[model samples]
Target: MKSSTFKYSMLTVGIAASLGIVSTANAAESAAASTPTIDNVATATYKIGAIAQTPVQSNKVTVNITQSAAFSLTAKNDDGNATDDYNRSAIVTPKGRVAFNHTLTNSGNVEDTYTLSLAQGGTIPGSTQDASSYDLAATNVTYTVYNADGTVKKATTVTGTDFQNTNIVLKPNEHADILISAKTVGNVGGNSQNLTLSAASTFFTNSDTTKATLTNINNSITKVPVFKITSKVSSTLNLNDPSSKVTYTITVRNDETASYAANANNIIVFNGLPEGLRLADQPNLSVSNNATIVPGNEGKGSSSADDSVRVTLLNLEPGQEATITFDVQKDQNETLTNPKNVINHASVSLDLGENQVIYDSTDGTDPKQNTNVFYPAGDDSEVTDGTTNTTTGSDSAAPLVANQRALSIVSPTKKEIPTSTTESTQVTHSVILSNTGKEVEGDKPGEVKFTITPNANNKVTVVTGSVELIYDADNNPNTPNAVYTITRDVNGDNDLSTAVPKNGAPPWTGMAPNSIVTITYKVESNKAVIDTTETTTVSLVLGGQDVPTLGERIAKNTTTVKGLKLVKEQALNENCAASTTLTFTQADVAASPGNCIVYKITAFNDFSNADARFTFNDLVINDTTARFNNKAQVLTTSTSPAFTIRLAEVADANVLPTDNTYGATASSTAVSGTVTNLAPQKYAAMVFAVKINPDGTTTP
Candidate 1:
């Protein structure tokens, strides 16, 4: 059987080789095969037999990628907007139009539509720290967008609510130029506004916003046409005199820049005359550059009042000045009692159809007024002589005789007399009596007398011997030598008992105009008068009669007499005695580098009428050998006055010391302060220690 199987396998192999197929007969023969065995199988597999087997295959998937919608926008100044970067802020007049040119650029990847808006009074983004932001209303503005070639793309006016609704489409990396026109609705200055431009993509709803500020330049640059009016009087003005004629050369100069020439119009110059002056005749008006002049109103019964003059002038170009000459007459009137009434001021105004711009010399914001006061020249007194009157005979003429006299009293030596000592001290005051009125010739030379009265609270003792009388050499050179007498009421009974007279006269007699009399006297005061300000009233008598117009003159002064003492001491040992005469030599300082020295400052307000504050200085250690140990200068004790005492070290040689070494070459330390509110009869003291240096060459 094996031989028969081998022959069959061989025969099958031969047949497979001829048919290109291989058989497993030999492997089956080698294995033990008792019978056809079939085991239980959980699953079954089926393989398709085919002429050819196809390889595993797959279908490839493709996709296209793109960028998400993203964009940004920015605003910049256009080329024609401003030549200089500093010109970003402009000055515009009221009711005037101003334009701001800007470029809106799309700085992002995608095309975007940018919306325009404005913001005011908020934190400005992309601005310098602490920088002032622009502020304005968007309702009064109009704008126009331009294409790259400068052609207008859109023009519209926006309201407050719809200002931010305007939009412009921009391609990626493209920009649009724009001009924003604004009109000033009212008078505003120092105002600022911001223009905000934002861009957003259609795919992306989110938008980015940018800001640019618009500043209104300072008023000095943007002010209306500046017109300066100056006037010059032809002759001096005399108070209460109608004969004098004043020709006023009024110069009106246009000082604004040429850019403001467009706003110039037929300027109406109006000047209102003050009281006591009237228009004399027609004004001589002329303009520079041949500007036409049309008479508006002149003289009485015209559109303008008799006291005011008005004229119409052609447009005045920048740097052009006009001159208007008008004459004014002063009529007879009562003399002014106040000195301020002796001069007057005039105001000028310019009417520019819609706006009345005023240039005030006094207040810049108001109108153009007189920058200087016009004063009355020459002798303006109406008085002639006592008991006599003179008049011009005209109804408007004032009486020649004055109703009152003018006298003035002034102190020359000291305006304030300070009482600094307890002992009875003399305070000398020198005074001058002058007549500041018009000249008067009397039947007999006028007699001018002065009586001085002292305060009742003061112990008045006048130094009769010091009384003197002299003439004012500058004003009254020809006047006779002054004769005066000073009488004091020794008992304060207001009587002329004790009299002292100059060498020539009993009283100031035969005095002339603009004459002056000098008197010097001394008074003695005691502790009873401490802290009491005394006023000495002086009465004047002219021609043996009390001068009603020459009112009484009073002089006031104060006195303070308090005692403060500073004592110094030095000792080789710890124990020391303070003395005012304590002295240290250079040899002593060289011997002991750390010697102990003491200073005792005592303040006593023994007779002070009021609370006192005292200051002491130059409490120093003088050592030429070496510098004193500043840190060792310690406060030893503060007692007495029963008040707080603050002590501090000061620099060297600064205080004005009582000792002769204050301005000397010696090295010294100083200190100063106030012992505030020291009561009468109270005392305070402070003691400090100082260490001398062996070598006085260092400071600490």
Candidate 2:
């Protein structure tokens, strides 16, 4: 273990650095040990020519390319390119094939030469990637190749079963070309494809053989398309009048930002309209776009580009709007006053390109929507004029009827006198009024104010009676003249008396046209009549004024001059001597309905007390000139004095004319028997004697 010091210099350092590693080189130069000078030195050794196994890792390459045209064409190539490692990686080449020898020999027997013929029929590859076929025949032997998998990759020929000394002839080989082309139709991805060639045969050495015919096969290529649509509409619509037209605007926009290359064809539609409200077919609609519209886009043809259709849309696409206008007319004959509140079917719709889109048909802006829109005009139409009929109750007080203009008296022609101390009058009246204008159910009746005009010397007095009114016209504000008094009929068994008010309104007040009212009374003369001469004073009144005289009346003296007379006579028993003639003359010539006059006559008895009682004769004579003479006879007798007789009724032939037969009846009776030669106007006579003397012995 001796240590030696080594010298180091700059020059030595430069030389050593230039030599790259001096220390390592010197260590390899000398390794000598004293014992046998065997070097026990570390030597770096490598197995340069040593038989050693080293694993060689294979490198694989992959590409993520889509099935492009170039990739598909490479996959369709039949023969691979020998220059490229990927195409010619494992190519099979034949240097030469072993030939089979066939011979036929015979030692003795016929000294002739035998000839053998071999037939070769086979398929050969037209290109490196195509399949081949081969068939060989020698003498009585034959061979064939069958591809069970249907793809043939290699060429093969079979020899006969045996070979002998024979001259053989063989047929020529055959070649054919195969076609391999690629096209893409759809999306493709993932791993490369391996094309395989298969073979099968019954007379071959092997059953079948397969080789990778092709690799990295690509799929067909194509392009796809997409579409989008949007729709919008106006915010407000006005359907104020059913007869007025309404309009709406709807716009649909079709957009394309999709990966697909195809253009879009679109349809727009809407639905849900109120009942009876709908759009007219072939509606006015227009469509536009950024590009010039094709004929199909303008609804010219059935291509996908067709854009517009005459229809309403139930649903709208986003951002698209439509406006539709239509005219409406309301039913004028509707009976309901508020028919506008009723809803009807109305809709705006679009027929979109896609048949799957849905639409709405509900109404939104109808004119009948608000109460103010359906206000009514005033019109009161009626069928007939209104009238009032009054059926008065027994205990009811007088009623007031409005709008009366006339009156009617129910009682017959009458006059009043002061004959009795107290007398009452009862009257009834019925009044009717026709409406001159439009009549309402609760309208007030017109007012009727009946005023009696008294005589000029005295005030008009209310005698009695009241009127019944059907309607309260007196207090009605609707009528200008509302108060009326109608005299109504009174009911009673005995004579019913109604007091006439001295100061109240008249019963026949406010009478209308054709209206009637009456006043009746029991009148008596205050003084006795002298010789049937009676007179009193009364004043008739109307409309608060006294009625003037009608015509000249007959004087009291003139009535007296037309004296009472007997116009006819009838005969009793004709027993009176020289029958007195019955005379006749006109009585007070008073006017009657038939213009006839009444008459009075006095009959006298002239017969004195004689042996036979006087018999007065009475007779009836048809002729006015005929007198009661001896033709008169006795009929009956009476004891009382002669009474007045009523003669025939008479009429002034020239002035008081009447029907020929007078409307009258006549009768008479006689008194007790007392005298003979009775007046011709009287009847029958008889005599009787005292009955006292017969009891004494002498009967007279």
Top candidate when judged by lDDT against the true structure: 1
- Model 2 lDDT per residue over 1-700, tens place: 0001111111344575685622210111121111011111110111111211111111111111111001000111223331111211121111101111111111112122222222222222221222211122221232221132333324323233231222221211111111212111111111112222111111111211121011121111111111111121211222445443322332222112211122223433322222333333333444343212111123222323222334322222232223333222222222222223322222222222212222222222323222111111111111111111111100001111122222212212222221111223111222222222111211122221222222233211223433333333333446443223324233211110121323343432232322222322222222211123222122212122221111111111100001111121112111122233322222111111111111122222222222122222222211110111111111212312112222222232112212212211222322111121232123221111011121212212
Question: Per-residue lDDT for 332-451 in model 1, tens only?
Answer: 342223422222222334443334353333122333332111111220112212211112100011112233345556654432222332222356566676655544312132345556
| Segments of candidate 2 deviating more than 4 angstroms | 1-231, 243-247, 254-262, 265-276, 280-283, 289-700
Which residue segments of model 1 deviate by more than 4 Å?
A: 1-87, 94-97, 105-110, 121-138, 145-153, 171-177, 183-229, 237-244, 252-267, 274-282, 289-307, 311-322, 330-700
Query: How close to the true structure is residue 529 of candidate 2, measured as C-alpha lDDT?
Result: 19
Estimated TM-score for each candidate: 0.32, 0.16
Clashes of each: 16, 143
Per-residue error at 455 for model 2, in Å?
A: 99
